[model samples]
Target: MLLKRIQPMAYHARRLYVELMFQVMGRALQAVSEVDETVRREARALPAGLLFEMMVMPDGPRLVVEHTGDGHFLYHGSQAPRAVDLSIQFKHIAHAFLVLSFREKTAVAFANDRMLVDGEISQAVRMTRVLNRLESFILPKLVAQRAVKEYPKELRLPEKLLSAARIYLRIVTHLFQTARTS
Candidate 1:
């Protein structure tokens, strides 16, 4: 009786955590694409109408992202009704949080059996590359180096300053808007 009573509460808490994780991830992706031309270019390569998702297994919270146009995507909230072209599943709530929180690199997480990818290998690879690039801009340098294989080095001094300014400005704006409504 005690275990049964606690189980429902635990499940709800996990679901809520997953939902929040995906929301932050979606907003950060939008901000990064807005500020970085490279991300925009890569997003363009994704086939139109393609859907990608990452979530906890067996009906937990999920983030739905749809490719809308060249270098564009729409984050369609959690559990949108649609066919997923690619879905990445975490084995547990802890795994989902670790990977999404940027504490574990996607490559490392996949390699370590922390995630399962369903769909075409090629598409998954492409998505991973796009994600890596996005991380470089969104994460701090010290943290990003662990997240990406090879960080872009050719950014000139002026370009770095400009990109940083744009990225930060957009992130702050996004957070403010999110906070106001939440």
Candidate 2:
């Protein structure tokens, strides 16, 4: 029936969107760690060689992040490492889409049981702080305010724009480099 066809198409579309957003987020985290002092500090706080992943359950797209010893992060694409220190799994692609598209803040999603965290509580807290800081830097004020629990008062408009530009450039460059190698 038309409804059944449309439903499958919609699910695929949402899947693709979540995949792209995960890629952007992974790259943004890496980019911010290199350029932002706050992110660098947070990354340093995490254990060296720590590997974390965020994914949608049951064969959905995922991204892995690893913390280097010297206060930086590396994006490990969708292939999870042999042993991940933390795994944040969304219960469904719809849940991931909602959070990735900024329709639902991460904390709210977690509260609503959209995600499952398999890791230490303290490590999850640290990672959440890093994610919130990255969102503040890369997203516009209005969207960022809605996406994060509290937008930082210290992030002025000019600084936000500049940081966003820098992060976007890194993302694009990384994408191109990856495409070429692929």
Candidate 3:
């Protein structure tokens, strides 16, 4: 297997991923830091009154990002927007913030033991929404994808399960989102 060629099987799950997640978060932190005075000024130009405080916690079998924000971070962030905290254990990076925007399915899965989540629930959800519109979309476009490709492709999944899971997740998530508004 490609994964085997690169590293031993011991480097497969949790241990391997903890390292990877930190790396991903590192880039995210850098993205936050690197935003220039002008660029951030524009990004912060959402509304004079809308700013937020976001905290993400990936603490579980699958990644669990917990968010805590009042939806106002910069200008009138004094009273806090509306505190939202939620937790979810999502296995794929692709589905990260997208799920948080519209559905609680992932949160349910985590609570039912099929997934995992820790800490506050509302914040988890808030963090994810911010990421969906902010880090997830903007960072990739601003930076090259090559930097985060160190993980071997095969380790991305167990070959037999990858195709089915990815396709199924995409379809289900798409349909769910589509159904949400209508």
- Number of the top-ranking candidate, with lDDT as the measure: 2
User: Which residue pairs clash in candidate 1?
Assistant: 44-71
TM-score of each: 0.76, 0.95, 0.30
Alpha-carbon runs more than 4 Å astray in model 3: 1-14, 33-114, 138-182
Q: How does each model score on lDDT?
A: 0.76, 0.90, 0.35
Q: lDDT per residue, candidate 3, 1-182, as tens digits?
A: 78766554443443445444433442332233233232244334243332233222343222222111222232111123444223344554323332332233344434544444444545445443333333322333223122221222332224324433443454355446647967
Name the regions of candidate 2 deviating beyond 4 angstroms. Answer: none
- Residue 130 deviation, candidate 1, in Å? 1.5
RMSD values for the candidates in order, in angstroms, are 4.1, 1.2, 17.1
- Error at 42, model 1, angstroms: 1.6
- Pitting candidate 1 against candidate 3, the one with the higher TM-score is 1
Give the lowest summed-lDDT range of ten residues in model 2.
34-43
Write model 1 residue lDDT over 1-182, tens digit each, in one string: 99999988886776677788687666666666677778778888788888989788877778887777777666677765678999988888777766766677888888889889999888778777777776676567777777787777875547756776776687578778867998
5-36: candidate 2 lDDT, tens digit per residue = 99999999999999999988999988888778
